[model samples]
Target: MLEIRPSCERCDKDLDPLSDGAMICTYECTWCRDCAEVLGSCPNCGGEMVQRPIPSAARLAQDPPSTVRVFNPDLMAPTSD
Candidate 1:
């Protein structure tokens, strides 16, 4: 299951699970749409952002999943040409 994060690692913006601005890489590295596009991609793995799946309230009510926080804030460095 995806560990839908709570915030963007770059801008520290809130990333609600149901927000359309939310995006994530294969590693579940979360980021906002702006940062993802401006940065040209995920700096950690150079992967592109894709729509994140939100668990239904019914499912969440039954068994809540774990939330993830950014651990490697420096993993993504500014990309230069």
Candidate 2:
């Protein structure tokens, strides 16, 4: 089951489980659509990006969305050797 993570790992944007702005990778690392697209893939795992599910109200109540927040500033940093 998806954890429906609370915010974008890049921009720290809040993404409600029912909102269409959420996207996730195979590792369940969450991001907003804009960041997901710009990041291109999960920087921490290099996994494909996909639309996150919008759980029904009952499902949400039973498992409530995760409040955990994740951020990876390196994703937006320029690479250097």
Per-residue lDDT for 17-71 in model 2, tens only?
8998899988899999998877777787889999998999999999898898987
For all predicted structures, in order, the TM-scores are: 0.77, 0.88
Q: Highest lDDT among the candidates is held by which one?
A: 2
Q: What 10-residue stretch in candidate 1 is worst by lDDT?
A: 71-80
Alpha-carbon local distance difference test for all models: 0.76, 0.86
Residues 1-81, candidate 1, lDDT per residue (tens digit)? 567788888878888776788888888888888878877777788887787777787766775645666755563566678
Considering every candidate listed, which one attains the maximal TM-score? 2
How much lDDT does candidate 2 score?
0.86
Badly placed stretches (over 4 Å) of model 1 are 63-65, 71-78
Clashing pairs in 2: none
